[model samples]
Target: MSNTQKINSTITHASINKCAIPYIRYKLVKKPPEKYIKSLQLDLFSQFVTNDKSEVSNTVEIWESIPKYFLTPAQVKKLRTDTGHADPYEWNYSEKGGNFTVRIQPALIKQGNNKYQAFFPGITEELVEEALKKILTIQNHGIHDVNKVETWVRFSLRMVLKELASRGRDRNINQIKHAIEVMSSCVITLSKEKKEIWKGSILQDLVTVGREEYLADTDAQHIGRLPLFISHAINQLEYRQFNYDRLMSCDEQLTRLIYKKLINRYRHANLINNYHFMYSDLKSTGLLQQNREIDNRKKVLSALNELKEKNIIANYETDERKESRAITDVKYIIYPSNEFISEQKAANKRNSDSDKHSIDPNLISVNKS
Candidate 1:
């Protein structure tokens, strides 16, 4: 069959039973509550519908259903001492929104008898995670074991390096390896109303094979496991999809973060309307870290200009509030580019197509064959 025909067939079959395991479970439930049944049906349908990575495209899937506070901002950086060695101290990042506070602590790793080091999740870690997600989507059909809390993913070190290269960044195997280690070691803790909802490392159970020379070779394969928290998050239906190529084309980390944040904010809004954000609010998200207001404004302007050059934003205007001739605050009004609007519309159509083809749960039956 042609690739298009094959994809259509897969989608049709998936829509019929929504995968065998979930359908079987649904049948086993006798008189399940309405809420429970709805959740189950949604979960079952989501397994096949939400992830459209199989369709030929340059876009990559990113999990956006999880609370944004759980993510460490681009501004977070690794600490270094005067001697140029990593600072062996623990630091905490906490953000309060409404009644909940999200906190992240980079767990200290023992280096020797008396030395310890802490690593924060930054751009490199983010790149590694994105590459992994892309690999999973391409090879595993973006399927994760719902029965297991942690899912094992096998990938070549060189594969990750190549993925990074495609995303407009080139790095050696050691750099990728170190980023994976940091992701595995860093601890993210979330609490709502003083009750801890979840806490875990971004990745865990990492294993690398091959001798030193072989491992250094570009073709060597390695494996890493996603933690329970991440695994559960992947099973959720809601997510954000973006053009991987466009995102990686960004030369600066700040610009990339700003683009992602704006895309998420603009998902449901009309493209004709202007969107605005306070400079202080952007700072709260960890995008701007300059100590002075003027410096921060410059950083924002530079990033916005880059976004405009990339055609992600059509244009942006900055409004400054002054008190006694001193700038008190700044607001940025962003105009979405046609390219970005088209991408959003395409994503919406894909989602709508998935929903349109969805079959009722009562009509689905297990295919024992």
Candidate 2:
């Protein structure tokens, strides 16, 4: 059967919104070009293809590949706008069918003689996300030498700022700076096992060596050192690659968080076409918060609609079952977008090929008997 026919059959029984689904009609390449095949063969055999850490690639770098737990659900929370300081909070939960418990605890970091207290003073999704994003850039590009005991990465501050506050022209420079400061200042312990075997901060040190010039277009370079634990974690976990452009285009923070959570949740289950999210599931992500349940529900729906309009997902089908004149146990069918599927497929293919080659370095020859 053709790809189009398979997709049609999948959607037919699902009862999805026809209008919002983008055209997924892609013609199959029956005979790939000789050059393309040769490149594929090279990719299959070559140990090295491209480095993410090189200066050239870092300029336009977007997609960040890091440990899933860093940005996954329950990592971040909604903060009140007027709050002066972020009160320390603890998160302990299990994900992916309760495979293992994930825990986050706010703690202090010791550097040399001085000790710094880590707090989320004005922590926002974008802020913590920026720090992770930059670190992900470093990890993805092989810019930092992992073999070294301490893997420190330095990157363009202005470039990151531009990407973080891409929604606005002026850029939220102050906000980004503060978030990085708070995140870098303190240490957070992440443990997965019941015995608390592993623990460390995502970042060890964040320093600005160059003085900031107010009028300068490009600010001084900023350096960040990742803890060995965090570096190892990034290398260990499987990462999902999505369209960074599409993700950033949606200005709403909540929507972006939802998108990421969905991506992380379904990173491995590609065959699972539909994801049914409950009301509590949505609220847990810190995407929606209000005094009343009704208000919060409205916000969740609004955010989902925004994602739908932006084509972040193919479409969302709402299942609002009324109980006591109030919507309870609201469920949603989140259809994966074609664009997202294609990107993930390509990323998985590349990763699988890389893993295959990495498995047996001596078996390089492809014998055609």
Candidate 3:
């Protein structure tokens, strides 16, 4: 499989609509001229790859012997297949089952109280500062009472924004601006009841981040853990509550796979199963007929079965008002959870907020004065 990368800055992405790079990166891993590299035999050269972390090669002794292990791309391919490995066992970046475009970034350093700084060229320093302020305020309260923690609160803010950029948000200015603010600012606050910041999906309106699947720390099949230099802020969502460190672990990798599979069928199984789908009600109200998808009773039944298997609702009976009015006419049904209303309310809340606080599109007009 040959691969190429497309790096974009809003304009290029607009002109080239298919610019969003998917999983998998291709590297030109080249071999050096024979006698010279062999003669030097430095410690950084790779030998055997364990879990694909190349950092382990530093332990090898016998300096001249190291160069022999610097295998060619063809040699690496043969060795990988010989060992029953499908990949070259190297640390690489990729999107879900898609090719990767190698992205490079400079490191960051913590500054004075409640501040952070990074050396990346593409983004503005002002943007970084504003994002850090918002995010730090939110997380600071989580880890320590904001009033007590005197200094910048010992957390890595840079990592969060970088997570967004790495997931491909940095490709567009509109998205970058939206994400930096969304990840940093307090769009929704905790409503004392669930300690849940039960606000609607804040970034839904903006083409800010990638799809929901990208919010998770995906597998090597997508991209490996983002570079450590970036902070948790990048991948953290205001409405979602997932642990960051654990998201990169092997267990999370498996969970991400399960989540993707399950979500692909989200509308069918989990959601429909829970709805007390009054076929008669949906039909009379025109939700079924107007929807065109659940036009007949069959899709509704299929959705109900999936819901039942997923345990989204409990079993019950449906009394068919106009059926042949028999005792056995009742069928089991599922009722949507109270949380469903919350999600809807949250969605509405998001709509209102967007109306109130959205950025002016004219400001973003490109290639013109």
Candidate that scores best on TM-score? 1
Residues 1-369, model 2: lDDT tens digits: 111210111121011222122333433222212131112222232222233212111111101211222332223334212332234454444333332233333334333457443343222434444434444454322233322223344555566576555434234665555555555554343333343322344444555554335325346655566544333222322233444555656656667667766665554434356776777665544445466888887877777887888765777787888878877678877887765665556556655755554445342332211
Residues 132-235, model 3: lDDT tens digits: 32333342211211111111211232344564354332334434443333322212211211222112111111112253534342221111111101111111
TM-score of each: 0.69, 0.60, 0.23
Highest lDDT, which number?
Answer: 1
C-alpha root-mean-square deviation, candidate 1 = 11.2
Residue pairs with colliding backbones in model 2 are 52-141, 53-141, 118-186
Q: Please report, in order, the local distance difference test score of every candidate based on alpha carbons.
A: 0.54, 0.44, 0.26
After TM-score superposition, what is the CA distance of residue 144 in candidate 1 from its true location, in Å? 0.4
RMSD list, candidates in order:
11.2, 14.7, 23.7
Task: List candidate 2 stretches off by more than 4 Å.
Answer: 1-87, 92-94, 97-128, 131-142, 147-151, 165-170, 191-202, 210-218, 227-230, 267-272, 321-327, 360-369
Better of 2 and 3 by lDDT: 2
Model 3 scores worst on lDDT over the 10 consecutive residues at: 59-68
Location of the lowest summed lDDT over 10 successive residues in candidate 1: 1-10
